[model samples]
Each structure stands twice: as C-alpha cells, then as structure tokens.
Target: MYNPNELLTRFRKYLQAEQLAKSTVEQYCCMTKYFLNYHKCGADRISTSQIISYLVTISSPVSRKQARAAIAKLYFMLGNHQKMNKVPAHVGFYAG
Candidate 1:
C-alpha cells in the first residue's frame, strides 16, 4: 500500500531541492494533504476528477486558485502530471 506521509516527505524534499520558499512548501503540502484526505487515497491514485471535486468545494476564489496551484505542484513532484499553464482541457475548468 502507498503511504501518503512517505510520499509527502519525498515531496517536501523535492520542494527543498527545487529551492522553493519554506512558506510556499508548507502551503503546498497542506493543500496536498487536504487533497489526499478528500479522496481517501494515496497520492499516486489521485485523479483529475477528484482534483476538480476538491477545488469546487473551496468557497473562496483565492483559496481555490491557491489549492489548484498546490495540487499542481504536488503532481509535478510526483513526476506524472505536467506544467500548470498547460493543464489539459478537461482540467482547465478548475485551473482558475
């Protein structure tokens, strides 16, 4: 079974390696954790639909955008998802 904490630890390391600011890393990780919790699944199993659903639940536009960016960063760290600006058409709705 995939462990979210282990994956998130790797994500934190990846953020450090990329030289992201400490606060930025924290925010991103927090949003990613929320995402993981919402889906009740491992990071590797997170889907585009799940991401959209999570974003939709955020009432604040600013928070919604931030969460979207954070999820994108997490996906980038995992090495499966692509750049944020170039997210697929299906994901554009939640990109904000």
Candidate 2:
C-alpha cells in the first residue's frame, strides 16, 4: 500500500542524500514518477519484465537509457536488490 507521492518524496530525498546533481535528481524523479504512474502499481510489486516493457516504449535511446537508470536507482532505494540487478544494461542499438 505505498502512496506514490510519498514514495516519490522519499526518493527525491534519497537521491539528494546520494549527492546526485540537482538536474540528475530531478530527471530521475520525473522518470520514476512516470514509471510508477504507467504501471499504477505499488513500487514493491514492480517486476523486471514490467520495467523492460516500459523501457521498450520509450522511442529515444537516450531517454530510454535515462529511464532505465532512474528505475534501477528507484529499486535500489527501495532495497529491492534483486529487481535492481535485473534491470538490463543499455543496448547500443536502437531501431527507432
């Protein structure tokens, strides 16, 4: 029963605590929020397959890479090491 807004607030604080650049934190939070809203599910319930599915929907390679990184970081902050590990690395090829 995670509240998305609360989760996002904590995530923002976590990113700041990690010393990420301000823009990077903002970008990551925005991407993470988009992912959360897309799934409409609790963060703990998100799976690697869902993450991959969402990543595939992004048309831009750069944006996809950033979203992947953001989602991975979100899972890391949630202490879900397994999900974090399952996030795929960026592929060099983009067909779109």
Candidate 3:
C-alpha cells in the first residue's frame, strides 16, 4: 500500500539515489504529477493495468516518449515489471 505522496517522495529519493540530474528529477516529477492526476490520484490503490492503460492514453495527449519513460520509472518503483520490456524503445526513453 504505497500512498501517492509516499510514492512521490520515494521517487524523489530514487532520482537522487540514482544520481539523475536535478533537472531530470524535476522533469520526471512533473511527468509523474500529470500521471497521478490522470489516474484520479488513486494513491496506493492504482493497479499496473490501469497505469499501463493510462500511459497509452496520455501517450497521445502528451509526449509519447516522455509518457513511456515515466511509466518505466513507475515500473522500477513498483518493482513488478521489466523496464525495457514494458516500455517501447521509440518512447524516447533512451533519449536522455
């Protein structure tokens, strides 16, 4: 049961722990915020399927690559899925 705030806080920590650039962390957080909002702010109750579906929807509404990268990070956080396998290579995940 990972609360959204807790999730985000940990995301922030992960960014720092992973040594991601500060700007990258900010961008990832912003992307995640939009994602969280799109999912109705489900907190710790959001499911993987819902997250994947949401990623598909937002991919068109927003930057498809960014959407994919965000989802990949989420998968990493959730620890239940493969990053590259779940995210398409064309999503610009490897761009940055």
Q: Pick the candidate with the highest TM-score.
A: 2
Tens digits of per-residue lDDT, candidate 3, 12-67, equal 89878888889778777767766666554434345445555566564445455665
Positional deviation of 61 in candidate 3, in angstroms? 12
lDDT of 2 by residue, 1-96 (tens): 457787889999999999999988987887766666665543434556566567556523435567777877877777666635443332111211
Q: Residues 1-96, candidate 1, lDDT per residue (tens digit)?
A: 336677678778888888989987887776666665655533434456557557657523336566776767776765646655433433211110
Evaluation by lDDT, superior candidate among 1 and 2: 2
- The list of candidate 1 runs beyond 4 A from truth reads 41-62, 82-96
Tell me the deviation in Å of residue 19 in model 3.
Answer: 0.8
Each candidate: how many clashes?
Answer: 0, 0, 1
**Candidate 1 vs candidate 2: which has greater TM-score?**
2
Q: What TM-score does candidate 1 get on C-alpha atoms?
A: 0.61
Look at candidate 3 and tell me the lDDT of residue 50. 59
RMSD of 1: 7.8
